[model samples]
Each structure stands twice: as structure tokens, then as C-alpha cells.
Target chain A: MATFAVDKTKNTIRLTAMPKVLQGLTVITVLGLIVTLYLGYFNAGTDIQQGEIQRIFYIHMPTFFGAFTAFGATVLGGMLYLAKRDDKWDRLAVAGVEVGLALALINLITGSIWARPIWNTWWTWDPRLTSAAIMALTYAAYLMLRSGIDNLQTRRRFASVYGILAFSTVILTLVIIRIRPDTIHPVVIGASPQNAQGSFEATRGVVLALLPSLLFYSTIVPITLMWYRIRLENMLDVLEQKKIALLSEG
Target chain B: MNTPFFSVVMAIIRKDLQAELRSRELVATMLLFALLSVLAFSFALELDRLAREEVVSGVLWVTVIFASLLGLNRSMSIERENDSIDAMLLTPIPRSAIFVGKLVGNYLFTATVGIALLPLMTILYNINMLNLWVIATLLLGTLGICITGTLLAAMTVQTRAREALLPIVMLPVVLPILLAAVKATTGIINNAPVSDWQTWPQVLLIVDIIYLVLCLLMFSYVIEE
Candidate 1:
């Protein structure tokens, strides 16, 4: 059961925050770094060919994997909202889009920086990049769709539906581009599907470092969503009361 | 047995078609807008005997998707502008039936334009676009678009920004089908063999099934509010 504490003297309401939320995020971030550093500096020795640029992999891959996890959350939140009619799920969907968008942007930038040293070109519409762009564009549109709808319930419902369906496009944009014979981007690097599919031979040491980062990123995403949801709920409450007061005065 | 369910389905379809026939204004506007879209693309790019196959596929699909938005907006608006959606809700018919009915209406309206475009595009581009595979992909792609579009249209119908918000909500989700359709379509136009598409056709089929089934199940809750 949820317990709420209200003080008459101060006119304040306090609720116990989920304590594990912060712990989990911190652990994940710390672990993510350890893994990244381990792969870059320690367990995996410098590659015979690409030295410093190879180090960026630690940052590039995890953020994207994390971004995919975040996009997947929108799909799940979308499904739950459709099933339950809960606004919590809707807020989670929006939060996932925002989180995923940030990470995807990072992933894209890191890849481009890495590409300049390796591919001799800063940009390639490789399957994965294409897919990422499409995914970001779709969710970005999801946000736009929500903004255009003034009615709260309708916005959530429509965006939830659109959110789930949009994820499907990521497949075509990313996967097809990867599979197409004409694509120029390397598979294992930032833009290729083959490399992403099974390219990195992650040592046991690398996995230990990376898994925590994944755990960390995933854990914080929901908390970020929950905080947003609460704020929205509070705004909604204030609006409703104002409406009722106006109705009574008239 | 194709019992009362099918009849109920037919009746719903008939009602929509009849209403559209009486008010031909909606389809006429959409068709006109679609043709003009084609005109713009033709003049802007000067699609001709020498135009590339990839451009042909891209132009045809783009026109279809935009025209779809037109049909979807007008069709769903019919319910929201009048008290028709509320009236339909009060009936004993299943919510899925209403969804299916709307899906069919949107499909027919959009597909009519799609069917016409293949020949029209062929004549303009000076290519034989009467390929069965391209036609099949178009049909599947349109089916996915309508299924997803109807649910979004229903939800958007109640919003303050009705027509304006439909494409914003739709294009991103509809992209995969569009991508696959465009690719397979180009391959067909370029005379690439069956060997070209090992799984593209399969992908389109899966997309259609997923969108239709998910929309069917979730549509009831969307309209409930």
C-alpha cells in the first residue's frame, strides 16, 4: 500500500520515495564506467590497428544498446497503457522517448567522431544509422502528436498507439539498410549491422563492466519517468480544482 | 459458418459506403489532392522516359501515403463532426466490428487511389508498373497503413487538433512498411528477380498482421474514453 504523510501545520504532503531507485542507477553508472575503462585501458589491450578511436566503442555501443532498451520500453509502456488505461504507463512512454532520444543522440555523435578516424567519412546512411534516425524521427513525431492534442486522455491514447507502431519502422530503417548490399558502413563499427549483431568479442572482463552500465541506465529511466508522471499528475490536479472552483462561482 | 458476424460486418461496410456515395465530396477532394500531388512530383522532378526506377518507386509510395492521410482524415471526421461516433457506440455491435468496418472503408478509399496510381505512374514515368509483386506489396502496405491509421484517427477525432495531428502520429509508425514496399517495388520495377527478396515479402506480411491484430485488440480502450 502507498502511504502518504500530510502535515496540517505546514500544509505539506510527503510521500516516501522509492529508495532503491537511486541505488540502482548509481550502481549501474559506476559499473558502466568500470567496464568501459576496463575494455579501453585494461582487460582488452590496444588493437594492433585502431588505437584511440577503438576506445570510443565502450561509450558508443552501450549508449545505443541502452537507447534500444529505452525505445523498447515505450513499446511496453504503450502496450500496458492500451490494456490498462493507466496514465502512468503513458507518462512512462513519454519518458522512454525522451531518455532514448538523448542516448541515441549521444550514440550518433560518438559514432560520427569514431567514423572520421576510421571510415574517412563522417557520415554514412548505413542501416543502423538510418534505423536510428528513423527511430528518433518516429518518436520525435510521437511527441509532436502528443503536443498537437490538447485533450489529455486523447493524447496519451493516440501517442501510445503510435508509439508501439513506430517501433516497427525501426526494423525496416535499420535492418534493411544493413542487409542491403550497397551500404558502405562497416558492420561491427557504429553503422554496420553485422558488427552490431555479433562483432565485438566481449571478454569476461568487458561483460562485467558493461552489464552494470546497462543495469544502471535501465534502472534510472523508470525513475526519470516516474518523476515526470508525478509532476504531470500534480498539474492535472491543480487544473481540475481550478475548473471546479470556476464552475461553483458561476 | 459465415453467420451474423459476417452479415454485421457487411452491414457496417455497406452503411459506410452508402454514406460516402451520398457525400462524394470527401473522396473527390482526396482524389483531386492526390492527383495534384502526382502532378507536383512529375513537374518538380520531370519524371519521364529517362527517369530512374528508384525515383519512380519513391514517388509512387509517397503519393500513396499522403493521399491515405487525406482519406483517413475525412472518413474519421465524418464520425466526429456529427454525433455518429456516439450513435455507433450505443449500438450493441462489438467494438472490433466498428474497427473492422472503419478499416475496410479506409482501405477501399485509399486503395482505390493506390490502384489508380500504378497505371497513372506507369504512363507518366514510361514504365510498365503492372507487376503483380508491386501490386501485392502495395495492397499489403496499404492494409497496414489503414489498420494503424483508423485507430489513430479515432483517437485524434476527439482532440482539438483533429486532422492536423493524424500524419504526425502516423508517418513514423508507417515507415517500415513504406521502406519495405519501396525497396521491393524498386526491385520489381528494376526487374530484379525473386532472388532479390529473400524475406522482404515476409516482413511486409508480418507488419500487416501485427498492426491489424494489435489495433483490433487495443481499439476498444481508445474509444472508451
Candidate 2:
């Protein structure tokens, strides 16, 4: 039952409640707020050249960076799982993708909302926005791929491989545009300054807001992961108990 | 020592081709669905003159994508239904060979639609559709789509919600291919300068290779169950 339930067979130093984990979350939130406030203060007098609501960049750029980092982590986790074939590695891959997928979603939503005020439209196929949208969608598909398979082993294997393959599309996002630049989205480099998509140049305050937000994000992901793992093991335990009870009754 | 890798590839490819030819079920369904999609979009778009010119690429690609999804879904579903996939697994072939062979089969079927759609769409839209670049992009784009789609289809085939789930998972994963293909094809249509299509071919091709390699490595794991 313990094997099926918690999987923590020979518990080393079981303290029951994980105070540090709880305290970790609280500290992340508090620090995130302080950093955000500091960012807002630093941006006080500096105005953006691209004009419209440069203020939003404080929130937006960090989200993009953090999301990219999470995706990078997801891909890395996928590689690790494929090499190691450990469920622990697969768990980390899932954790990274889910959190990364969320941040990517937020990046898209906030970018669109910000675009409305800046670009005077809800959306533009700007390279950054279009690529980010595709990234979110790609990883979201990675989630569905995970869900479609119920066998724990196969699910982990296939999803991790798919996750690794996703990096190709990210490459496609950059190079494909460079190869065929005449479409709607602006190119970020090489041809002309005019071809550049939304600027990612980070102001110092943008950096402040960005750093804490990433910290907040990184902190939340593992806890959610541990919680999900616990639930999964608990569900398995209940199933085992029912099976055992039936056998004993017979 | 030589491993007979090439022979293994040919054998798997031949087997898959033989299976599809014997069945003839997947291509027939795909062709019908492809025709239906093109027809629906034609009527829906109402063939406005400028509209046809402007949306030529969109109309052509969407039809191909949706039809290919139907074919991709059916390909694995049929294998599972007949337990052929399991039987195939019983063979002593390397699982990676199976992945490559399935990809070849998928590309053959999808590319047939790609070739057929050229004249069909040209006639329907009343535009000159034959061009070197157009054909090149068609081949490249469909290959990119099939490369990933085959992998996704195999993964989704064993699931309970097979039908509804395959495309939802596939489309998102292939967004880059879709975006690049559409953009490149659209550029070709507009007769834009070469500078216009400088990146997509390279990007799409790189993506195709990456998926091809990754699919091979992971396919053994996928079918192991």
C-alpha cells in the first residue's frame, strides 16, 4: 500500500508537514511584489521610443523571458527523460512544460492586450507574437499528447520525445522567417532594421520586474509538481486498497 | 560489419506500402475528404475574383492540412483496429525502421493530395498554379507536415478519444510548419522577390529533420506498450 500510495518507502527524516516548502512560496510572493514595485519606480521618468504604453513592457518582457526559460527547461527535461527513462525525469518534464505553457499563455494574452493600446489592434502577426503563440500551442499539444496515453511508461516516453522534437519548431520559428521573410511578420535581424519585430530591449526597471516574476514562477512549479505527484500516488493507493479488500473477502 | 540497415529500411517500406495498397482504404478516404474540403471552402469563399487570388494559398493549404489529418488518423486507427501494429511489432525489425517506413507511407499519401490539389485549386480559383517554386514549397511543406503528423498520429492512436484528440494535438505541434508554409507559399503567389522567401525553406527543412530524428529515437518507447 505504501509503495502504491506515497512511493517514499523508507522515509528518511519524515517531518510530516513541509514548512520550508510553504515558507518558500510565501517568500517568493513577497519578493516578487517588492521587485515589481522597484521596477515601477525605476521606470518613472524613462519613456520608450516605440511610444504607446511602454509601461506594459515591465510586465511583458519578463514573462516572455521566463516563459522561454521554462520552455528551455522543458526541452532539457525531455532530453533527460529520454536518456534516463526515469519517471522522475518525466515528472520534471511535465512540470516544466505545464508551467512554461502557462507563462507562454500569459505572454500571448498580455501581448495582445498590450498591442490593443500600442498597435491599435488586438493582434498582429509580429514575429515575436506569432512565434510565441505557436510555442504556446505546440507545448499545449504536448500536454494533449501526454493525456491521450494512460499507460504511465508509454505516456512519459512519447511526451518527452515529442517535447524534444518541439525544439525543432522553435528553430523553425526563427530560421523559417529568415528564409522566407516576405510574409506578414517582421524579421528580427539581418535584412533591415525595418524588418525587426517587437523590440525585446530590456530597460533596467524591466529587468527588476522580470527577475522576481521569474523567481515567482520557478518557485510555484515544483510545489505544484509535488502536490500532483502526491495526488497520483494517493489515487493509486486507494485502487490497491480496493483490490486487496476484494481479494480478502473472496 | 554492415548492419543491413538499408535493406531493413526497404523491407519496412515495402511492407507498409503493400499493406496500404491491399487496403486502399486510407487514400480513398483522404482523397474524398480533401475534395469535400476544397469544395466547401470554394463555396464558402464564393470565388470572388480578387478573393481567389488573395486567398489562394490559404485555401490550398487548409484543405491539405485537414484532409491529411483525416488520413493520418485513419492510418494508425486501421493498424490498431486490425492489430496489425502489434503483429508488425512481432517482427525482428528495428523499431526505428517502422517509424521511417510509416513516415514514408504517410508522406506518399499526403503528397498525392498535394500534387492533385494543384490543378484542382488552379482550375477552381482560375489562377495559373504551375510554378517551380510552388511545387517545391508544396513538396517541402507537405513533407514537414507528414514528418510530425505521423509521429503525433501514432502517439494518439492508442488513446480512448482517438478521433477528437489527434488533430487538436497535431495542429498545435505543427504550427511552425503551417505558419512557415503559408507564409512561403503566399510569398510565392505574390511573385515577391527571392529575398522574401529567404528563411522558411531552411527552417521547415530543419524542423523536418529534427522531428525525423526525434521520432526514431522515441518510437521504440511509444510502441513498446
Candidate 3:
């Protein structure tokens, strides 16, 4: 009974503190999003070839990075949960996957829109595209696997195993472009940049716009979303515990 | 003189084979499914000789993959039905022994079905799929597929969705194997320059080794009651 009282107070403190933090984060993210949009639109220079369609790069590249970051978090969360058996880490893994899925969708959709203007096809089975599509599907299956299991502990264990294993796809997606020279996608960090067909040079203005967008989308937005998601999960956890406690006592 | 681990693995493999031979269920379904799928592809594609030669690799792999999915589900179902997995788990044998045993069993089932279909595919498309390179690629590729598929089937067998969920969870994870397999098969078929096709085998070998080690390491987690 004393422990239950302690639990109640702890839950209250966290519940009270969460919304203020979330409110502050919301204001900051909205401001940062606005600035990113301004930098992307009014500040970036026009591409030599792709024109305005090239501007999509400002979002597409950063979102892919963001999704990659989120997936990295998923793997970390899964590893920690497996090592420690903590529900918090499991929640973090769940949040990472959900947020990563959204970011990956943005990456794929913007990529499609961008490709139509540049590659002249809305979709191609290029290695990078194929890998990203597979990565998205892999995590989608991860989520489905979570839902299919009825036992909570078994579900968490399976999810941890999958979260760790499925990261191969993310690594494969990231490297396939750099490793394969035949890819049409530009190699931002490797030898095949010269071979890239429609890749534009990152000019001074483009670099400036790209910097903040990368920082914002890749870290700030994902962290903010994860914070809120974790808070919501904590609330659900507390309610579930309370319900179980009531049932046992009654 | 077999080490205990080897004995355990071999015993499980032998048990599975004895049961399968007695029932003849998994391989029969897989073989029939493979043949029907190949026939279906021929009817649907209706390609000329030149076109058929180009498409035979793709057609053959698609048929084999789908058929192997059927075999894998049935093989895992046997464990699920009589609490056979529980019986295996109750043993003191290492979890990896069970995994390797299932992997070898699935490999033989899927490979037998895949190899039997090759001649039929050759007859249907009038292309030679009997070459030594094509057969080698088939063996290596099916080994990779069965290793990954067996691990995933174990993970999925207890889920509420059971059989329906296996392919969804398995396919994307096994994309590297499928991609390399198809490329290697196509390379052998096209008689492309050795340089053009050399990477496929390398990729298959790496993917197979990685998946084998990873799945072995992770099997204990999935099998934990």
C-alpha cells in the first residue's frame, strides 16, 4: 500500500511536468519548422537543371536522414530492453518505429515527387529506392508482428529481436547507393558523385538552407515527437497498472 | 564419434526427415505448387522463344519462392500441432541445434521442390536450366532462403495470424537473398560475362553467412517460453 502511494505520487509528478515540456517543445518545433520552410523556399538557390523541383531535396534528403536516425534509436531501444527487461525501453522502441515510419513515408513520397521531375519516372527499381522500400516494409512487418502476438512478454521479446535484426535493412539502404556505382541516385559522400546523372552542386545558399533543415528534421523534430510519444505511453502504462491493481484488490 | 551438439542436430534432422518421409506432405505440396506455378507463368506470359529465354530465370525463381513458402509453413505447422516444439525445447540440447536442424530440413524440402521443377521449367520454356552453374546457384540460393525462412517461420508460428503472416514478415527481410539469387540465376541463363555476374555469388555467400550467424544467435530469444 505504501509502495502504491509512492507510485501514485511519482506518476502525478511526471504527468504534471510532461505537458509543460511538451508545450515548450511544440513552440520550438513550430518556430524551427517555419524557419526551415523559409530557408528552403526563399533562401536556397535554383538548381541548374531541375529548377524548383530540386527544392524537394531540402526535405527529401533530410527526412531520409531523420528516418535513419529514428531507426538507429529503435535498435538502441531494443538492445537496451533486451539487456535490462525494462518497459520504458520497449516503449522507446515502439515510439522510434512509429516515428520512423512517418519519416520514411515522407522520404518516399517526396522522393517520388522529386523523381518524376528528374528521373522522368515516378518510380524506379534503383538500388537506393529498392532498399528504402524494403526498409519501410520491413518495419511495417515489425509493427504487424507486435500486433499479432497476444502475450505481452512474448511480444516485447519478439519485437526486440526484430528491431535489432531489421536494422540490417537500414544499413543496407544507406550503403547500397555508395557501394553500387550503377545507381542513378547521387552519392553525397563517395566516389560515384561524378557519375551521378542529375545531381546538383550544393552552392552556398543551398548549403545554408540544407544545414538548418538537416538539423531540424533529423534531430529536433524526431526528438520532440518521441518525447510526446513516450509521455503518452507512460500515461497508458499508469492507467493499465491502476486497472490491474483494482481488479486484484476487488 | 559425434559431439553432443552434432548428435542433437543430426537427431532432430533425422526425426524431421523420418516424419516427412512417412507423411510425404510438405514436399508433395511444394512440388505440385512449384509445377503449377511454372505452368501458370507459361500460360500467362505466353512469351516467344527469345522472350522466354530472357524471362525463364525470373519465372523460375518466383515459382520456387512461392512454393517454398508453402513448404516452410507446413513444416513449422508440424511442430506447432503436437506440441513438438515444446518437446524439443524441453531437451537439454542447445537452441541452435534445433534451429540448424530445422534449417537443414527446410533446405532439403525447398531444394528438392526447386530442383524437380527445373526440368519442367526447361521443358515448358525450351531453355536449358540444367547447366552446372544454374544448379549450383539454385543450391546456394535455396540454402540462404531456407536458413532465413526457417528462423522467421519459428518466430511467426505462434502468432495469431500464423501461416498468413509468415511471408509478409519473411519476404522483405530476405530481399538480399532473393535479389542475389535471381541475379545469379539470370547471369547463368544469359551467359553474361563472368565479370558481370561474379558479385552475385559473393553477395549470396555474405548474406547467407550473416543471416546464419545472426539467426543462430537470436533463436534463443524467440524460443524462450
Per-residue lDDT tens digits for candidate 3, residues B1-225, read 489899988998899899889999899999888888888889999788888877888888888788889988888888999998999899888999889988999998888888897888878888888988888888888888888788888889989999999989888877777778887888888778988888888888898899889888888888888
True interface contacts reproduced, per candidate: 0.68, 0.63, 0.76
Worst 10 residues of 2 chain A by lDDT: A11-20
The CA root-mean-square deviation of candidate 2, after full C-alpha superposition on the true structure, stands at: 4.5
Worst 10 residues of 3 chain B by lDDT: B173-182
TM-score winner between 1 and 3, please give it. Answer: 3
Docking quality class, candidate 1: medium
lDDT of 2 by residue, A1-250 (tens): 1233333576222224444655566566666657675665564335566553555555554565556566666677778887887666776677667766776677677767767754678987666556667777788878777777787777778878777777654555545455444444433223434454454455455555556655555545334444455445455545766777789999
- Of the two candidates 2 and 3, the one with more favorable DockQ, higher being better, is 3
Candidate 3 whole-model C-alpha lDDT, 0 to 1 = 0.84
**lDDT, model 1:** 0.74
Q: Which candidate tops DockQ?
A: 3
Local accuracy of candidate 1 as per-residue lDDT tens digits, A1-250: 2334333467455554444755565565566556556655666555446765666776676677667777788888888987898777886788777877888788889888988877777877765567777777777877777887787787787778777877776555446545565655455424544343223445554565556555654555444544544455555555665677789999
Q: What DockQ does every candidate get?
A: 0.59, 0.52, 0.70
Docking class of 2: medium
Per-residue lDDT tens digits for candidate 3, residues A1-250, read: 0111114535542325445667787889999989998899888888877889888888988998888888888988988887898888898899989899999999999999988878889999888899999999999999999999999999998898888888888888987776566688886443554457668776788889999999888898888888777767777776777888889999
Residue A126 of model 2 has an lDDT of 61
- Among these predictions, the greatest lDDT belongs to 3
What's the fnat for candidate 3, on a 0 to 1 scale?
0.76
- Weakest ten-residue segment in model 1 chain B by summed lDDT: B45-54
